[model samples]
Target: MGCSRPGAVAIVSVFLAGALAMISLVLPYWSKMEIVTAAGEKIEVALGLWGACTSVHPPALDTLTAPVIANGSEVIAIEPESALSDSFTCGSFYDDERVRISCTSFRELANGQCKRREFRGPASLCDVATTASFLGDSTAVVPDATVSDWLSVVDNACHGIGHTAVALAVLSAISASLCGLLLFVGITCGAIESRLGRVGGYCAFATATLQLALAVLWTAEAHPIRYTEHAFATSFYLNAVSILLHAAAFVAAQRHQSLEKEALAAMDLDGGIHADGAATEDKEKAMGSSKATELVAV
Candidate 1:
């Protein structure tokens, strides 16, 4: 058969690894970054598998990443402390999927203070409902005039890199699953000695090991650049754990093969010893009979 008891255990381990890898892909297994705005307000946000959720909107079932706060389309205060006696509304426009700012303005007022304005131009992912209102100044749109951009820039520096990381995570999970399956098939086949079965097992083990190494290497590469403001979520770790389990199974299978070979060699040695002992006994008996005949002749 393909495997003895140890081989069976390896098969189980591979299956577990594959199952966990698939689960990791679906779970919200990335980091939640709590970005603090100028007003010392903590904005909780998570990105990757479950999508992007910002503390700006409450967690929702519909979007992968929704705003935490429910104040739809409100001003994201870049300069929350700056007094707005004459801070007129700046016009906004979409630059690709993201909105761009041309100037600044107030949207709402309470107690003679600006309470809401436009976070008006944020990324597509963060276009969640805000309480930001228009500055009602259509004349504020500037054409080719040279004007300094307002301080209303949202901190989405990690966003572009985060998307790249997402793709990597997905690919890693898929590769891991495939390798795990190969390992499983190799261990469960009763025809362990068959060329196909042996090839399957070896290929599975090699692929899994290589994938694990590559995943770690890629994570290291992304760490300094991407995760400076973020972190790895539970799902990422789970995926790594799956890869580790495959390694464990590979080790187990190797040990089992070693022991099997040792047993066969020992058995052959024992048979040879027994045969030699029988030959020696037959020779001794023949010699004794000849000596007796010679004695009788004397």
Candidate 2:
């Protein structure tokens, strides 16, 4: 049997979902904030699983939306330059082990150097705590916030959470790849009831479910202080779209399987009726031949 329309569409959806997953994995724009400075300058900060990126935007841009105004009354003012300090700040605050962590946004080379800061690396929450301790004054201040105190303040939210999230994301990608492989084989063999097809559908659903969890965890974990505006960035949105695609693929695969099973059942029924008719005709012919022989003998 040739590949059904639903099967073809499911395969396409799987391919697209895998592509989106890969792209989202590498790009570092999971969460974003626009910080309005005291000088009317805007600094955009993007946080990702691997790293963080910051860019200075001029206040003259009228198209800027989602501005987190730092008016000391509404949105507490934070020093734009001090917020995501350059790699130099990491050196001043963090020791040698923590200082070397490099997290550049989208892997871009800023001034031919990577953005090396406490908040840029995969262990950004831990690093951010250290930086916050050094900064002293914060909009969200914990009384007597030492480095360890800050850690406890957030209830050790950074402890292995980022790494675990990264692991889950990778697992999601791997599952998606396996799903594509199984789906491709099913399409080629035209087997609707193939165990491979069922497994592929399971994989797709698993990927979607895991990604949804990751999205929720990331949103909950990415709340840094002193910013009023918050939004999920392009990479985050891409993963979300990928999740939907995977879900759609699962539905299509199920439909294709059902249609193929029904067709197979119909074919079996028709073949059984034809066989019964042929057997009855053969039996009648044998009876007539015996009667003719007996009459000749008489």
lDDT of 1 by residue, 1-298 (tens): 5667767766677678767767765654344444333333334433334233333311213222322332467643334223222332222122213222222223433334433344524433223222111211121331111011111111121345444444655665655566556546655654443343344345446646654654554354334423224566676677678777777667766655665577779989999999999999999999999999999999
Each prediction's Cα lDDT score?
0.47, 0.65
Clashes of each: 27, 0
- The positional error of residue 280 in candidate 2, measured at the CA in angstroms, is 1.5
RMSD of 2: 9.4
Q: Which ten residues in a row have the lowest lDDT in candidate 2?
A: 87-96
Each model's TM-score, in the order given? 0.50, 0.67
Model 1 ranges off by over 4 Å? 26-28, 37-43, 49-182, 191-214, 217-229, 281-298
Q: What does the lDDT come to for candidate 1?
A: 0.47
